[model samples]
Target: MKVGAIVTRIIRQMVRDKRSLALLLFAPLLILTLTWLVLDQESSDLKIATIDVPDSIITTLNDQQINVIDIDKPKSALKNSEIDAIIETAGNSLRITIDDSEPTNSQAIMMKIQQALVSKANVQQVEINHLYGLELSTTFDYVGPVLIGYFAFFFVFLVGGISFLREKSQGTMERLFATPIKSWEIVAGYIIGFGLFAIIQSFIVVLFAVYALGVPLEGSFWNVVLITLLLALAALTLGTLLSTFAKNEFQMMQFIPVVVVPQAFFSGLFNLENAPLWVEWIGNFMPMYYGAEALKEIMIKGNSIDAVVLEIAALIGFSLVFFVLNLGTLAGYRK
Candidate 1:
């Protein structure tokens, strides 16, 4: 066929297949817009509640566009979330309460408050308490396990999805279908193979974060293993389910920007303190959020088994849902 005729034929085919065309062009845009709305929600200028403050400090804050809420009950202001941080200035000492959930914003607010205090006089070291940590902590200390969980989950998802797609394209899946074996049996076989590898991957990641990266490991090692294994199962189930939607390796890759990146943002790797409520709610739907939360609890907070059972339960529950969907998606192959 001539080049122009071939091109015309291709356009006709694409026009006829509206679903593929939309997946190629519009899905990314839709996801991008949602992510933008999630991340760009405007934060009110730092809300500061004070018991007593020098006129100089007050003027400096106003110049910085800080919303100063003069209040007697500093506790009530924080409890109500009316203020982002509190600065109680009594005598030469200043007591600061930083929410610490939004570490970046909280740090900025704390720094500005400190500078305001120093400008007033030779301030002795101020008493600072992070409502989250109660003491100074490293960012890696906070997010290291999360990063580990994410990297492990991301790689496993991609690998499993692409491998399953390969099986479909190579006719291997069809060959197996011709046999007496059941659809769920095929899924179970893949799981048994991938599950062992996933366990190894989780172990290496956890060990690297703890020993090499110096990430804290305060909880029971067994709890960490249990959570990681469950998280790996979730990734494996999601990968297999998504493979049914992807016709090829390239299409399998297309799932990442839509399915994977959002999890990272809402997975507690980045603080979602100021994120839109809808976006934050979306996190509750993603398996990574629970996995990372469980990891953080075990690694950083040193939470006990009782503390993380719900997170573990939720992760397992999500995996089971995906597993059922994975089986249902294979039903078309059944005789």
Candidate 2:
């Protein structure tokens, strides 16, 4: 009888929280659906334009299992980043200018072209020029640093935001204020605690991405570490600052889609060729835009530190702005 009564009470309590029930049952499904949509899919067909190719070569290309589009001008197609590679036949030799924005596509196109010419006894050497990615390695290599920074930023943001929110919700913040704590002191303490964690987290995440995931780290590892720490600090400060406006943990969670999602759209994940002029400007306002760009340069281009000074400066500026805003927001909690 006692066990039955306890079970009934537990069921009643769970039933009362409709939101909790819905989140428990539906959130995992939604996440898995999105993951499948993005990462677990097969490679899309690579579209390429052949310009002035010989009749024999064209016939061989047509025989291959690939999408071939006959384009009027090679310049237009390449400029638009449409075609993966342009095959132009001048006499017996083929001149290939590959849209090397993505390394995998570049490699695939090169391999296919070679296979198409395999039967020819006099295989002319094709000159290959990469449009975006130079003599670099993998396509995933470019996104490595950016992904590391993003994961660090995201995790710290959620953890810090919720921690600060809990302090307010549990009335611990009020108790602290009643004692000798100043608003800035409380903010500083939170920053230090979270900031230390951010440093360690950034190091581990970057190292894992570079060494374990085989994401290229052409630049100095310390520079990557410094940039990741700065980015995480920016996220931490932004999270704590935003938490001031949030009434509860649910409200804090709402900020993710609003503030974080748009950044990804501009962060080099998708080719932004079709984006509007205004949309391009929106990227200039985002911190991730600079971070992703610099990260790409460092990892893929093996660019020197001087090459990314502007981006590093912009990231520091973002951190400063968020820190100042955080300090201002904490004034609200002051007695």
Best by lDDT: 1
Write down the lDDT that model 2 would get: 0.70
Per-model TM-score on C-alpha atoms: 0.64, 0.66
List candidate 1 stretches off by more than 4 Å.
1-126, 130-136
TM-score of structure candidate 2: 0.66
Q: Which candidate has the highest TM-score of all?
A: 2
Query: Across residues 89-205, which tens digit of lDDT does each residue of candidate 2 receive?
Result: 777677888888876677777777776777554676545446654533444555555666666667677777877788789998787668755566666666776676677777776
The TM-score that candidate 1 achieves is 0.64
Clashes of 2: 0
Report the backbone clash tally of model 1. 0
